[model samples]
Target: MTVSGAARGMLRTEVDRSLKTFLDHQRAVGGGPDVVPLFDAAEDFLAGGKRLRPAFCYWGWKAGGGGDDPAVFTAAASLELLQASALVHDDLMDNSDLRRGMPAAHRRFQALHEKEGWNGSAEQFGAGAAVLLGNLLLLWSSEMWRTCGLPAEALAAAQPAHDHMRTELMCGQYLDLLEQAHGENTFESALRVALYKSGRYSVERPLRLGLTLATRGAPPWTDALCSDYGTGVGIAFQLRDDVLGVFGDPSQTGKPAGDDLREGKRTMLIARTLAAAPPEAAAVVRRLLGDPALGAEGVATLRTIIQESGALAACEEMIKQYLHDALEALERAPITTEARTALADLAVAATTRDT
Candidate 1:
């Protein structure tokens, strides 16, 4: 394996070990029978992720001259809990049925209700259980961070960024919900949602938090450079998701084709299509955009309109630009060469992947 690949493997192993240990400890000592399913759901949900956030954290620490340490891995893995919480809540909000190719947490709970012939509305019970489970994961995110054995000073430095990340993530989510509700399809608005909802939390905060934990006093230039890199890559990551939502193969993405259309996400692609297409064509798009009953034929028609309107090309160009800017920031970063190369590889992967 390449250096970055090996490091990633090691980090993944460490994170899995630490999470299992912590969850097992929780299972052994905490909660009643009602909460056991919550713990099980968390473990299962956490087991299948790509661990990208933790990888970013680990590489950020290395860039800040951190040593090879298991403690950093444990600390980095805490981000997974935060991600799990966000996804569970996001799935609920989107009313999505699947995650990572499995029934989403809420749907799983709903199924459990049906299997056991439990009384009460199955959907409501599932939603309530999922919400509580999401809450549990959020709480555990902080708990894991605090117990990761980092020095008090390090935790103190990292706390502000950590806190800001959580707040910003929720605010972004609110923006997304607001846009969906209002059917706001403006490109600028979509960009704003992407920035707040996924970009900062996914890239900037993780890098900042890692730097704060790994070093007592990084130079201002280094911090700024990391921020620039993170922002560019993070935005690119979201834009890529927008593309994948529409065009990605279901086998790779683990979601049906045109899932975003069904969800009525006002992504930049849709915005651009609306702006560039003829009025009648745009009307067709707007009409069919959010229908949950939209079938494969509808998806194909919309995809053709988006493609012929040049919106897909436009979004792809923007992704390339942001990725270029991110790599440029890496070029000027004052980190070690190994760290720089790894980060650049990660940034590229973030932008240029099918899943």
Candidate 2:
């Protein structure tokens, strides 16, 4: 493989190893049979991902002229645990059955309850277990970050980004849940939710944290440029994800087709379709959007509405526009040539991915 490719592969291996080691230690030292499922769920769910957050963190550091250090890898890898915590809770909130082609953490726990002939409601037991498991992952992520052995200055500089990432993610999730409850389906609100929910955490904060570590403190201009680049790219990533949610190939996406529709996701695509569609079409879409029993026919109907209403095209254009803006931000940033090039590539990968 090429040098950059090989380096990325090595980084993935190290990140996976670090996470596994941490989880393994926690599992070994923790409770009994009851806790095993929690640990098992985490390990299994964490086993697969694009490793986007870690890569962003690593490359952000490199862009700021940091070297390839193992300690940095450990710090970056910890973001995966935070991501896992988010996914577990998100799945529970959405009542999703599958994640990465496997049963969600709650579902796994629910199955365990059923098989073991445990008392009480299996669903409630599963949900409670999932919540605790998610909390544990969040706790572990914080512990790993705090104990990464970075110098005091670097840790302090990076801590705000870490704090903001978690806080914003939680707030975004709350807003999402609230939006669904109130049935507030506006294009502007959908974009706002996407920004806070996925955009900031996925790219901006991780990049900022890495840059903070690399520089020991980020200069104002450096922070601003990374912010612009990361936010633009992150929004594009979320937009692509929204499109994929409704129309993507199930095998590639690792979820059933129309999962988002069934879950009643108030996405930008849905917003746009509602705005652009005829009243009758919009009404039909609204009826089918969140039905738990949304079948293939319902999915196909909504897909048709989205596509025919020009919403999908509009969303695609938005992705391209955001990606263009992200690259432009990169061009304006003062960073290492190699790192800039890699980040540019990452922007494309994040936005254009099928999964």
Tell me how far the alpha carbon of residue 335 in candidate 2 is from the true structure, in angstroms, after superposition.
0.7
Please give the CA lDDT of all the candidate structures.
0.89, 0.89
Candidate 1's C-alpha runs over 4 A off are 1-4
Clash pairs of candidate 2? Answer: none
**What does candidate 2's lDDT look like per residue over 1-355, in tens digits?**
1237777788799899888878878878888886676788888888999999998998888887788677888899899999999999999999999888898889989999999998999999999999998998899999988887677788898898899899999999998898788764887898888899999899988888888899988788677767789999999999999999999998998889999999889999989999999999999988888899999999999999999999999999999999998899898888878888888878888999999
Q: Give the per-residue lDDT digits (tens) of candidate 1, residues 254-303.
A: 88889899889889999999999999999999899988888999999999
**At residue 50, what lDDT does model 1 achieve?**
75
For each candidate, what TM-score against the reference? Answer: 0.97, 0.97
